[model samples]
Target: MTRHTLSVKSLRTTMADRRAARRSRQSLERQLASYTSESDRIELDAILSRHSGAEANELRSIINRQAMDRLIRTGA
Candidate 1:
């Protein structure tokens, strides 16, 4: 393929990846909202805003685990 064609393909892939990540983040935020208090959600958002890269991923993983635990405990 030509260089221009390759660049366009890479750009498209990057955009798709970003959109998918945004959807996943929104889904997780919605899940947290369903069970968390407003104050707690605000705090969580603050923490997220301060972190990036692996730290953010770890926080999200922890949040997802805790959410799952709550669901299981509540029989929901």
Candidate 2:
């Protein structure tokens, strides 16, 4: 409709997308934590803790990949 209304709608959509991404990231982190040992989980949490914004998501993806790789190699 109006320009202002369109801008508001876009902002709301962007916020929703960010929230959904955050939830997905959290779920992935939880799954990764479950797959690792306590010491490794602590290290993973430390790595996962130091990042925020876009880098946080990227770091989480990297951690997930690494965990999967370890599991594959270990056959665990």
Candidate 3:
């Protein structure tokens, strides 16, 4: 049997786990602008999932959903 001891070193528990990035108001607008077509919209939505844990996500969801509803109703 062999036993070994290592020297003490600085370590961070969170260094390996990546935190989801927080999006700013301007960043959200830029993201919105990137969507031009239905395919683009789907891609944008996939990318959006990363930073949507914040309070603003609900607001944007409500607003965009309403806009989509209006467009469908108007048939335009």
Q: Among these predicted structures, which one has the highest lDDT? A: 2
- lDDT of candidate 1 at residue 5, scale 0 to 100: 100
lDDT of 1 by residue, 19-39 (tens): 999898778766764656557
What TM-score does structure 1 among the candidates reach? 0.51
Q: Which 10 consecutive residues of model 3 have the lowest summed lDDT? A: 1-10
- Summarize candidate 3's per-residue lDDT along 1-76 as a digit string, tens digits: 2232222121232332323233354565556655557786666566666665755476457447755876888899
How much lDDT does each candidate structure score? 0.78, 0.79, 0.55
- Candidate structures ordered by lDDT, highest first: 2, 1, 3
Ranked by TM-score, top first: 2, 1, 3
The better candidate by lDDT, 1 or 2, is 2
Candidate 2 TM-score, true structure as reference? 0.51
Range of the 10 consecutive residues with the lowest summed lDDT in candidate 1: 29-38
Residue 22, model 1: Cα distance from true site in angstroms: 0.3
Model 1 stretches with alpha carbons more than 4 Å out: 37-76
Regarding TM-score, does 1 or 3 come out ahead? 1
Please, what are the lDDT tens digits per residue for candidate 2 over residues 23-73? 997887666656467587678778779877887777677676777888899
Model 2 spans > 4 angstroms off: 38-76
